[model samples]
Target: MNKRLLSTSFLAIVACLLWATPFAAIKIGLKYTTPLNFAGIRFFISGLLILPFIPKFKAKLRGLSSKSWKLIIQVALLQTTFLYGLFYTGIDYLPGALGAMLIGAQPLFAAILAHLMMKNDKMTWTKISAILLGMLGVCIISLGRADFVLTTTIPLGVGILILNNIVGSMGNVIVARDTQEIPPRILASFSMILGGIMLILVSIPLEQPNWTIHPSEYYFALGWLAIVSAMAITIWFGLLGRKGVKVSNLNTWKFIIPIFGACISWLILPNESPDFISILGMLVIAFSLLMLNYFNKKRIKQ
Candidate 1:
């Protein structure tokens, strides 16, 4: 492979693997905390952790333009609040692999949204085919198992996760426009801080907001997730701002996440294992990403 391709692949792998970790971690955390409360505290702490990296944190805050502030809040509400409000809750009812797999479809959604919203990134036939393959991959996963019986919770969980990804896709579009205008770290910090606060407020009413952790696993989850949020968002947004990377191209890396999530879940969580059908489905999902990203790129270059 070319050196640049190798480097890009490495970065994408690292970022996606980091993201993949949170599904199982959240599952562990939710045992001791409600979904909302767990998500709220994790993001809030992560946001705070981002402050020391800023050149002049306090001065930057004071100097922020009103437009910057508004963008920050808008990102907070759309990216963090609305997206995660569904995600953390939805993941609760899903198998770790399944949930992560669904979220991995995000690029497909983003591609469609970007084509509709951004003039340059039009929906090519290749992209449309890629989107259908991705959706089919999701369906295969959802429809897996000869014994797979549908339940209210499972269906509801799927619905919530789908909604979560849609909101997240929209966030990507919004963030992509202003990515160069604002620092990724600053945006990650404030948006997370504000969104975390919003989630915490919602948790107080819905989940009573568990303030303590007894299980060591809950602490692991919280700490890991916080770190993931801080690091991943910073890197992810920074990547999105790169001159040639489209939202879909950058997001193709997301396919690796479900693979990591499933493997970790199977290894650590005794209760979850991938069936043959699900394994097949996951392969399909992974291939769809290749179709959208790798092959598409090759064709464009050719």
Candidate 2:
């Protein structure tokens, strides 16, 4: 039992690590294309990337029930379309490190939603305290930005990311609740395809359509984003369906994302650098994760 627990937790960490790369990758890709256009192409390709991995894929699609299909649509709409719509838009306006830090706020929203939606996932004081500390890290990092200003774009980007977290958390809970009938890969694939198509269609009227061919850097970023989305989202969905895995606990692994993402952004993005405040915020976030884990282990033992 402990072995299974450790394996699932490890896989969850792996998924978070993959997720960490997208902030910098997306920032790189956005330089060549518009937000919705870039996001649509990335996700559409990611959905396609998953098809080769599934065994007997044709038969599996043919066998899906209406409920499964509905769940897929719901998740695709919320998680992929709306979530990434806001994500791309927000990340476009903010620095990569700030964007990653804002996204690291997901566990707080996920914990609250899971508490309300799942009886088995009720909140504990330790969990609440830990989430609050993580949020503190987010605030610290944001406030520490050299370009920190009360500009329209700054607040708008922050608001969009907050909404993204809510929508993402809701999608996570829905998948956790109704994933019994569908395989995780199939759910992730169809939803991402449908959502990506929707975004592409919407982008035609909302944003300027791109026609020119791009350089190798654009393709590299896009390819990396798609590959990570396919692997990470599939892994995350699988973990969401695993028995005895709490949504809040699984999402807590995401704390590592901001740390890696901020560091990567500082290293790769010419405009980004690590400040003492940002590093301190990351340390606080790491300490909160440790506290959460210690409390969780104690709960399990009890």
Best by lDDT: 2
TM-score of 1: 0.84
Residue pairs whose backbone atoms clash in candidate 1: none
Residue 126 error, candidate 2, Å: 0.8
Q: How far is candidate 1 from the true structure (C-alpha RMSD, Å)?
A: 3.4
lDDT of 1 by residue, 201-240 (tens): 9989888866764677778778989999898887777777
Q: Which candidate is the best by TM-score?
A: 2
Residue-level error in angstroms, candidate 2, position 203: 0.5
Clashes of each: 0, 0
lDDT score for residue 267 of model 1: 88
Q: Ten consecutive residues with minimal summed lDDT in candidate 1? A: 141-150
Model 2, position 51, has a per-residue lDDT of 92
C-alpha RMSD of each candidate structure in angstroms = 3.4, 2.7
Off by over 4 Å in 1: 1-9, 56-63, 91-104, 138-147, 152-159, 266-279, 294-296, 299-302
**To one decimal, what is the Cα RMSD in angstroms of model 2 from the true structure?**
2.7
